[model samples]
Target: MWLGSEFCARHILRHCDTLAGLPAFWTREQHGEEASTWLLFTHKYDYLKHLADRYRSRAEPMTRTFSITETAITTSPPRERVLLLLAVALMESFGIQVNLCLDPAYRQLEGFVLDRQRCAIIANWVDIDAVWHVDVNTNKPDLQRYADALDHAQARSAIAAKTPTGRLTALAGLLDLDWQWLTHRCGELAAYGSAGIADPHSRLLSTAGVDRACGYVATVATHNG
Candidate 1:
């Protein structure tokens, strides 16, 4: 629904040793504010269940919604995959809704997203470091293709087509691309997602150059912009 502060599942598992140690963004002093933490999961499946029960109660929204990006289910080890399935079940039991992010990738997590409230469908392309990167940038036409393919698959699961096995109701993932690209891309893709598409820690505003977090962009763009 609304974009507040978002933290990826793996990052939380990596940085916070205890639930109480969660960033103040999600665990602030004020209790009356309307806020929520978007947990964009990519992996580290084992710890997700350990968190599902603890987070909902502490966050602003008691029954919070969590999000997960396209994960490598088909390629991951069997043990991790099983853990992920179990984690999804646990979240469901806790009354927290989970949404699938990214432009329909045919990950076959239909059981996880079917009829669930849609969350953020972010398409950000970020470079955390020289060796590590995240790319989800996409266009409206691309998303339509994904939706059409998914429809075909459902129609032919009888000779239809398929990609990720579900229809994509997109929102936004702004500040993902460089200024030159985003200025144009954001307008074209806004109808698909949100208008601003910003998350303070992860996808904050920038012009497009280089820094420690985002690798490098066109010369006209800079880190502070």
Candidate 2:
């Protein structure tokens, strides 16, 4: 219900830039969905060759454009070796960005591993913790950056009276987060030019079908990411 509404809003606001993480976009292009459906997938050699050629053309500029693969989190190391490491390798081979929709229960080891990949993360507000949930993490050569601001601005509470400000300070205050730090982090992300993605319809269709599937990510950041 919430996601469907969000997709509708995006359609009214912006045309999608790249339709990342949507298999149906490639698969229904009559790109058959097979084993690739269960595994981390990308465009086939056809589109890939094109991406490669494009990568070479932009070589002199030493720049490449990328799309995100939002995966469900399998959570933690050994699982990541296959689930993340290999997938990251495959994406980088063709040039793509990877972001994980991480659970706030994520551990310190994850911080270290993700730091190595310089991968970005999306964190939800519910995980019981506070703003420590970093919304997105971007890979910058020799740098690890974070976007702490949320795509989510206001949240709903049952039987509560609310007003302007889009959110009430008193209720938000109950979250017990350090605002000074959160705002500062947002500034740092802006300074570094960190970016976030708003997805459109999958398959590059006129509009992404807002099914229960639209919000599907199992464990799905980087696979769960």
Candidate 3:
């Protein structure tokens, strides 16, 4: 994984609507060149000239609104530039920031940002299939709790349509509530089944309850006598 830069970050945000629903990763060199060529080949001079004009017109308004000094515009350091570009790229394309650092084993140098805060200390070395096990150390609070949190969150999401029905004798009053009220209180529960809240089994189902969509197959080997 590559570190993000603000320039690229802004560019990404600018074009994000064009690039959503893509796979998680992209070929950097290819993408960069392609983007550059796309900008150049499609009425090249007119595009850049228009960009320059727009930039100039917006510069004063941006400075006035943000109170940025001229020095801030003229002398940005290299790391800052890279971070700026990457951030712009991320913001445009993914609407997020870079906060996570990939575990060293992948040998790819991309940084990660869990849910988009700027804490970049934690790293996960596990394979992608086992990604759910990645933990957030104390240094990385934004991501420290996500591993299990994601699982539980997903579990709760899955079970939203199902009901818990071991026994209701202890609270018959609660259990015997009107169907219309329950349905009105919880509408998301309707997606999974027909009976919904009226059914005896209206508690949320587990991840196991949700059917896998695609490419999730696995196999095990057996030795027989």
Candidate 4:
């Protein structure tokens, strides 16, 4: 699903307590360290991919794709910038010094938490264009495969030719819940129909649960602090 950076961050935080809590994996480091930043990011990416797959599996079958107007991307700042900002906020909240790396060749933005020696504790990579390709059934981006993919001219050309109105699959659309209330209530509404309630708004609330906007607010509070 093509979700904004803020939404992505909150959704991840909602599932996992914090970035630090993400599962660790072994990397091909000379020291054979398990906590390599790249490995940590790979685990994180896998977790997100799993969640997306789960959401996709639950969606109603449909072949149609959803798209927003081209103006949306032109008018708003790039989604990567927003993600970088949120990542910085999250790391800083934990009193970690972070460095942001932008790789134009691959259209990737990475955040690295730096140690005293300026080595990375962990790093996270977000493909800015993944939001546009969520519904395309393409291979999901991963740290290990990223470097090799960058050298493919055809891939770069395809990304460059992407339209302003990005397409998403029906399942991806369902996964792109925007508001906190809607996200929290989506599962409920899907499980139980609107029960023939009178008022439209009331029916929505009745079928869904009470608004719990606190998730976003709490995340923001942590970022601000």
Candidate 5:
């Protein structure tokens, strides 16, 4: 049950009275439903938007091109990691139980907001990607395929790590300069998962699919300004 920012915002405005009160309400509400996920997402977006505004105010002016690379993302003083950690902290402040999953490829780290009361996975950061539901009711064939591919890739990389030659090959593949290939493959998978669900909300969600949709908006504003 993936939801876009607008849908989340609208739902929150209709159902929730205050952002601070959301966690309690969501905890008491039913899990694994689209409405519940939307409420959670609404809070997530609100927190991210506030964080982006704070970052924009404190950010130093610079003209250098912002590059997104595995090394740039996972190494010490990583920008994405820092921002995501901040997001996790903020969610915790609101009483939301969130978890982070670091991809084996180290390309990206995903955050999942859990329904602690039900011990269920509710919503995840599906930024610029398809939102996945790990519940029994929803069909996630495309997500499963993508997960299988990722597992296979990780398994191969693990085997390749035993030898110097194999290590070099694995490193080359991981650090492959062609990020377009990776992004394209992810877009294809998202498209497949979202097939036949092309409503306006879905389109907005896809466009804003990165970990924090607000962060992407903030980045563009910073660059353009």
Candidate 6:
């Protein structure tokens, strides 16, 4: 018994046209009767591929154009490797189920993992204690990196939210990027489940979805920032 119905997922998609034709937007809460229905549906992979490519292109430039590691948290190992390790730990510790896509296109910054099993994004940083219903581990690199990434992402997002132009531009890009990932993820998960396969849907889901799903499931944060 999940949280919502197919109607709910459809409603959400209808309201946000950006979500149109995208897969894997539904939360576990919305998986009761609609799960099988959606699982049987087909998708346009070409569309999703295009969307992912475009988003990666848009976001990747920021990494190079700014030539800024911005505010990276370096550990004993490489930051990116540490980030990957941290991501794995949090998923095991918290049982988050968003699908993940590691280095899609072999782009370094494309280290997104989505938890399609849970209809969320697997964040590099998570407030495990705050949302995982578990004691906080102060020593784990996963925990620390998650904290740093969350703080940085939040601060930047807040600033972007405040700026009218920034907000508009970001929201537009995110909607498209997010929607593409969601659809691709949903389809992938459904396919896996159908074939009795068990790979994660990293490309279709993202950190953004994880953040949203955690907030909803754990009630750790309010969606209305």
lDDT for every model? 0.27, 0.25, 0.24, 0.26, 0.30, 0.26
Candidate 5 deviant stretches above 4 angstroms: 1-3, 8-72, 75-79, 104-225
Question: Which tens-of-lDDT digit does each residue in 140-195 have in candidate 6?
Answer: 45434433343344344422443222332243242232423433443454333423
TM-score of each: 0.23, 0.23, 0.16, 0.21, 0.26, 0.19
Clashing residue pairs in all predictions, respectively, total: 11, 29, 42, 0, 4, 24
RMSD (Å) per prediction: 20.2, 21.3, 24.5, 17.9, 16.2, 18.5
Determine which window of 10 residues in candidate 6 has minimal summed lDDT: 59-68
TM-score, candidate 1, is 0.23
The residue-level lDDT of candidate 2 at 90 comes to: 31
User: For residues 71-138, what per-residue lDDT tens digits would candidate 4 score against the true structure?
Assistant: 32234343322222222222222222222112333333232211111122222223344432111111
lDDT of 5 by residue, 1-225 (tens): 334434333443342222221121111111113222322344445644443443344333111001123333345232333333223323333323332112344233222221112221233323336543222112255334334433444343321333322332233233332323433433454444423343235322332223222232222222211
Model 2 scores a TM of 0.23
Better of 3 and 4 by lDDT: 4
Q: TM-score of model 6 relative to the true fold? A: 0.19
> What is the per-residue lDDT of model 3 for residues 1-225, given as tens digits with 9 covering 90 to 100?
111222233343344333222212211111222223221222322322333344443322111000112233235443332222222222222111111111222223222212223222222222233322222223555344433333333243211211111111111122233323322322233244323323324222112111110001000001111
For 148-197, candidate 2 gives per-residue lDDT tens digits of 21111111121122221112122123223233343344344334331233
Q: Can you write out model 1's per-residue Cα lDDT over 69-175, one digit (the tens) per residue? A: 33433344433432333232233333333233333344322211111122112211121222222222234554454444334433433111121111110111111
Off by over 4 Å in 4: 1-3, 14-90, 109-143, 146-225
Query: Model 3, poorest ten-residue lDDT window?
Result: 212-221
What lDDT score is found at residue 99 in candidate 1?
A: 36
Best by TM-score: 5
On lDDT, the candidate that comes out on top is 5
TM-score of predicted model 4?
0.21
